[model samples]
Target: MHPLVRWFHQLGSPPYFDRFAARWAPWCHGIGAVTMAVALWLALFRIPADYQQGDAFRILYVHVPMAWMSMAVYLGMAIYAAIALVWRIKLAEILAMACAPIGALYTAVTLATGSIWGKPMWGTWWDWDPRLTTELLLLFLYLGVIGLYAAIEDRRQAARAAGFLAVVGVVLLPIIKFSVTWWNSLHQGSTISLTGPSHMDASMQLPLWLMVIGTHVWFVGALLARARADNLRREAGKAWIAETA
Candidate 1:
């Protein structure tokens, strides 16, 4: 194996991951928090009102970012699951477990805020659009992961099984992304993209970006903190606990 891959597998040990998570998690979360705060405050009061949606349009900022995160996090979960399955790494399993709730939260936020935005734009809160349907499915998928783990007494077996589901669920993500373009829907096409933002102006774009960063910060902080807590609980009788604690 390559040096980087070997390093990653070794780093999957609980103690090493816990220590590294301790350091990097705080830094990512802190920087992400600062970034989000600056972006949100500026967006809330400074940006000019939308000529169409007015102040209610502000919710779009939050909605879009969370929607993006909903998809991104599912992909992240898949990667973590793959790591656990291929490497048989214990920390990788826990980390995969850690990501589910965070991903679910983003999915929930996406649906709620999308509803708030929809009331004015579409005359209804929901219309069974592909994006909404797929996102709902995504949330169910997260719950399924959590449930699968919870139902099992054996941690490793549970992780492996749930990890398989996570990997398979990612196949649905692209269908959600292209659903707007592929089918007729009230939901708008991608505003933010690889080649600069498409529809959302910088004013709308700015706050949405901030919310994304904030969500990311929240994801990192919550996951690592949970991961650390899990490590402590699971390693209650291990030698490292006595040494570290």
Candidate 2:
């Protein structure tokens, strides 16, 4: 078997994943925390303020990462959901379920920080801009998945149901991604791009990139923590838990 295939097979084993998550969670969290602090320091103290937005632009350090994570997490969830539905992989199901609350939290953070930033610029707490509206819908979709899974009694059945919803809701992800470009909106265009030069100064962009990487690292720790807890609960009667404990 290919090395990558073997690794994935190992990952699907509950005991292996549980042990891996236990060992790696702290490292992920520690690195993420330290990186976030450095990013915050650079954003708040080192980087020059925007000429137009001034100090108000500092909020991007938080808001931009949260926004990016919100969509990235959902896309991840959808992929896991697809895997679970196709192959009935138990690990995939747990991962898909675990992603919902984390994604929702990012979505909430994005909304809150966006609102705070907007108040000074747009002179309002909220606006029904295309980007904002689609983002709001993304949050609702996350909540819907969480609620639907909880409302069902059987774990497997609930996972399937929620997985279906997650798969269907993927349509919204593209909408959220393109809303700014597809329509006129109060939101600005992308500051970073893969195919084009960034529109930001190198100093400003460095901290934002650090924050984005830190957010994703932190999310891995959170996801592992949640997946472990859920695995224990779902396997409360299993022998592996006793052996590991």
Considering every candidate listed, which one attains the maximal lDDT? 2
Q: Give candidate 1's error at residue 172 in angstroms.
A: 1.1
For candidate 1, lDDT tens digit of each residue in 49-158? 78887888777777877888888888888898998899887787888888888888888988998988889989998889988898899999999998998888887898
lDDT of each: 0.83, 0.94
> What 10-residue stretch in candidate 2 is worst by lDDT?
198-207
lDDT of 1: 0.83
Candidate 2 local lDDT, 1-245, one digit each (tens): 99999998998888899998999988889889899999999999999989999999999999999999999999999999999999999999999999999999999999999999999999999999999999999999999999999999999999999999999999999899999989999998888887999888876798999999999999999899898888888889789989978
Q: In order, what is each prediction's RMSD in angstroms?
A: 2.2, 1.0
Question: How do all models score by TM-score?
Answer: 0.90, 0.97
Query: Local error of candidate 2 at 124, Å?
Result: 0.5
Residue ranges of candidate 2 with Cα displaced over 4 Å: none
